[model samples]
Target: MGEDIGLWGVPLAIIGGAIRVSTPFLFVSLGECLTERSGRINLGLEGTLVFGAMSAYAIAYETGSPWLGVLAAMIAGTIFGLLHGWICSLPKVNDIAIGIALMLFGMGLAFFFGKSFIQPVAPDLPAISFGFWSDYPQVQAALKVNILFLIGIAASLGLWWMLRNTKIGLRIRVVGDSTDAARAMGLRPNVVKLLSTAAGGAFAGVGGAYLSLYYPGSWNEGISSGQGLMAVALVIFARWNPIYCFWAALLFGGAGALGPALQSVGVTQGYYLFYAAPYVLTLVVMIFTSSAAKTMTGAPAELSITK
Candidate 1:
């Protein structure tokens, strides 16, 4: 009975970890998909994520509502996106360099504003329960999922549908494929890129909010651990598809949980290696997905990196 219980617990723990950890990746990767689809990249998303976390934490602490914190984070993210879009649209300013600069700026801003908010407890988000049918403790633990995970799934499906079936989606793809063609077709490529980048920033910001308000529930200097950057890599591995982003996020989440799960099971040696698992997996995925021949065909033509 004990062995059966232990064996069953592993899968359940992995599921719970997926729900707990994947929410941010889902938001950021989906957002990055939108930006990349419009032939632009926003490396500043790291900054956006951190700033969003800080802004969400502050607002939620002040307003006494976690939802309001999320709203504020979105607004802040939108503003950051707009700023990034406006700046990147300029002549001779490399988008990648601009992204890096904006990341530094955003991080600075977050640190400055978050200085006074070190210890306040923000309102917590409510978790959804689906454990009613599970009599086993392991089953109940696994079935307890975050509401954001469901939201992320719905958002991915909605984005996938819109990108494949909607007119705006078509326009965005066209712009990403060839700016010259977009201009010839009487579509403003710059406008499309700007809007998409802003939207991406908003998503990244919300991802940040999820980290501070939901998962970790606190703010500090090192709150984000490269999840924003990894989401960018994940987007490529996901082939710029929102639905794939959902699956990729869950996979990364599981990889992240592996270390802690091992620790929980009384296996603590090589903890550092386990901590590196997600990044290692990300690197492996990127190497496989970003082959010279494959990316030339798969990547949007107007995109500067893949080109």
Candidate 2:
């Protein structure tokens, strides 16, 4: 059956890989969207992600429950986010600089703590199999979806609705777009930014948990491979919209899957080059979205990147 599929399998495999690979992008981008929406940028999510992955793996290994591990990761992410938010709120401190420092700090902490868990096997998150009728094992494997992806989808929708409908969301948008305006309205811009940054970290941490507990399903120093950082460019491309973030993440996932899908069909030539697809796509997105003379549409007025 696999042989019969022939070259047709490439696209199928890509589709499967897209579903698998897009989860982390989906999460980190969405989280950044939240942070940027509040007039702050968090470059340290990479560290938060790695740390989350390590902690999730460790907790899950010790507790025998992946969900507990996920919770722990979220808490850890919140702490990291809070730290970033607090430090950035200090006078003369740069958000980007603090983020970079935190990223390194988070990664260092993760590595120091995660060394022992490199050899330990932890419980993995379960997937929902949607390809029950598939005759091919590859198809079945491709159809198996993780629960976190679904949660991310819901989060996107919920975030979109909140941003448009809720009072708190209005405050966040207000603070992000203009701190002075937020102050005029009696909103505490710093507090809003702090909470939003922390919330963003929580989301990034979940993305990391998904990495370690599900797809690629392991804890290691090399697990992230810059997905956390690339997500910043993705947020720019997504125009800070949660819905757009979802689609963009899937697009990135498809691009990332291309090389692997080709290799599955014995197309090993230039396979290493194909791995660069996501990074290339990120550059393309950044180039097309950015304008030196004009601020990006839908961008917060207070956002440093757009300035």
Candidate 2 lDDT by residue in tens digits, 244-285: 999999999999998888888887678879999999998887
Off by over 4 Å in 2: 1-4, 293-295
Q: Kindly report which residue stretches of model 1 are placed more than 4 angstroms away from their true locations once superposed.
A: 1-4
- Give the TM-score comparing model 1 with the true structure, all chains together: 0.95
Local accuracy of candidate 1 as per-residue lDDT tens digits, 54-132: 9999999999998899889899998998899899889987888998999899999999999888888888877777997
TM-score for all predictions? 0.95, 0.97
Minimal lDDT window, size 10, model 2:
1-10
Model 2 scores what on Cα lDDT?
0.92
What's the C-alpha lDDT at position 105 in model 2? 99
